[model samples]
Target: MYNLVRFLQKHHFFILFVFLEVLALSMLSRSHHYQRASINHRTNNLAASIYHLQSHISDYFSLRYQNTILQKQNAELLHKLALAHLPEPQPDSILKERLVDYIPARVINNTVNLRNNYIIINKGYRDGVARDMGLISADGVAGIIIGVSEHYATAMSLLHQHSVLSIRFLKNDQIANLHWRGGNYRQAEVVDIPSHVIPQQGDSLVTSGHSFVFPEGIMVGTVDEVMESEKGNLNSARVRFSTDFGKLRYVYVVKNVYQNELDGLAKIKTNE
Candidate 1:
């Protein structure tokens, strides 16, 4: 108590001055309209500044909530972007939705070192995913959806020798077939393009979306080397996929709303 009293006494001169000034100002403010307005304005501004500071501090600490909101916003925006790029989904068109109808999945099981390996996703029919769906990573096409359950799905990795994906050149727009040669997981083959098209090195290859599997224009790979066949009119090239199949972690499985109809038609034609 003595220490407190002594400290107050030491600053008492300034404290008294401030107290007297406030008292005079209060009286003057009540007597003069302009002074009252000035006092109120200053008080309001001080309060506003304090409130603004508090709000900013609170926002800075609520990063978890803010991050969740941002993630949701990003997902919604990407969905819309996907819709804008999809095909028109003509009634007779084989491409199902040709738009934003895919579920993002994390790769839980994968294989790239072997000739016959598959991948498992965390999504399934319960998530509106189905079999034969197209699977793609952000960097490029990964594989095709093969089977699905209520809570999970399986993708036929492009590393599978039995897998065949049709691709096309981004430069001359020539169509080709992509298959694994079982040599390198990072590389695949684009085969059977017309020799006349003359594909050059570094040409980009992407999904043709001709079948009911994937959307058109999905990135597949790039032509790293073009080999002219001395025996036939067919040209073969090595493609470096936008995605590293061996290092795949996450993927998106595309669902065509009209996949059944498209596949049925194809089956009917085959029967015919």
Candidate 2:
């Protein structure tokens, strides 16, 4: 108490000034209507200004979140664009065409430097994410879901050793199996392409949509190598993957809303 009194004595003049300022402000707020109105307006303006400043800061920090939304929107729009350019489904088709569902997800963990690496995403069952869904980025397809937990899932990257995506050449449009040799990080193999089509290096390839895993026309990559398969029946080539798994920050998991129906119809056709 003695120390407090000593400190107050040392700064008494400044304290008095502050106390007088507070009392003046209080009087203005309580006395004259015009003064009170002015005070209220000024206070409101200050509050609004602070809120506006805070909003700008919040938006600045949320750019990444906003980008995730935009990326998902882009994926949805691109999927629709690809379908729009495609021919109508067959008259006897069982499943409806041109309708694909998309679940936006962020790549929480990714690795491209190692062979047989898997990617982890920031979505799971709660978000309707499930195993076997096709995962892709804006530049191109990434991989397929192979494992799932309650709130997380893992994907077999396009560069994984056992990864296989039904793909085809874009120029001559020869169907083949896309695989990785588990060595190269940026390269994929397109096997069983008939040599009659004259496969060329740098030929663009995309998803064949022959299976239930991925829809048609998702960009995979360009042909990086062309050679005769060991079996020698058909030509084989290596495709430089479109998405660089090492640099991935965000991606989308494709959910086919009518997948069950489509898969059933596809199975029926294959059996026949």
Candidate 3:
């Protein structure tokens, strides 16, 4: 009680001045219409600003949830598109079977500088993802799944040295093999192109759909430069990859519904 008394005595003049200032402002606002209106307008604006800031903070925190929902929607749309591309059923045959399915995944880890680049995703065997499944980004092809655990999967990125993708030219449908040489992550080379087929710059390349991994017409890259083979029998071209591996975040795993049937036929042919 003694300390409180001393403190109040020391600051009494300053405290009185602050109290008087507030009292004077209240009286002015109450007596003058212009002052009251101005004060109310300022208070409303401050409240609005506070509310807007709170709303932005909330949206920032909920971005991951929104992204997950969007990913699922995109996967469903891709599945529908695949079904729509299927051939019409014959009069005697029913078209009740689906050809492929897309599983949305988030890329948790990725590398682009290494000779053997790899991508790690949040989905695995439990999520219906499996080895040899094709991985693609929103823009284009990203990688192929090489291993899977219960809750995670690893993929061999298209930028790897040993990576090879079957690609077809959009102009003439000439098939070629896309290979990486361990340099630029954004560039690759398409080889085994026929000598007679000339690929110009800006030519689009897409998946050939020869294997059960990726579906047909998934974009791969664009021709950057043409390099004719020294032997003159085959040609190759530099390609700019459509998917930027350094910025990869979300991807889709392609699951071929008829993989077992295709694998059985492939094994039979191998035995022959």
Q: Pick the candidate with the highest TM-score.
A: 3
> Which residues of candidate 2, in runs, are more than 4 Å off?
1-98, 228-232, 263-272
Worst 10-residue lDDT window for candidate 2 reads 34-43
Residue lDDT tens for model 1, 176-240: 79988897888888778887877888888888878767878888888899899897789888888
TM-score of each: 0.64, 0.62, 0.67
Write the residue-wise lDDT of candidate 2 on 1-272 in tens digits.
99999999999999999999999988765633322332332112333344445544545555685587567767998998898788766654555455678788776666787866767776767888876789998778998776665566677778765577888778866788887887668887777777576677788888998876788888999988788766657877778998776666567899987888987888899999
- List model 3 lDDT by residue over 1-272, tens digit each: 99999999999999999999999988756634322322332112333344445544555655685587568758988999999788766643435666889899877667899887877777778899877889998778999887776677777788776578999998999988999998799999877888999899999999999977899999999999999888889888999998878777768999999899999999999999
Model 1, runs deviating above 4 Å: 1-100
* lDDT, residue 23, candidate 2: 95
Off by over 4 Å in 3: 1-96
Query: For residue 266, what is the lDDT in candidate 3?
Result: 99
- How many pairs collide in each candidate, listed in order? 0, 0, 0
lDDT (CA) per prediction: 0.73, 0.74, 0.80
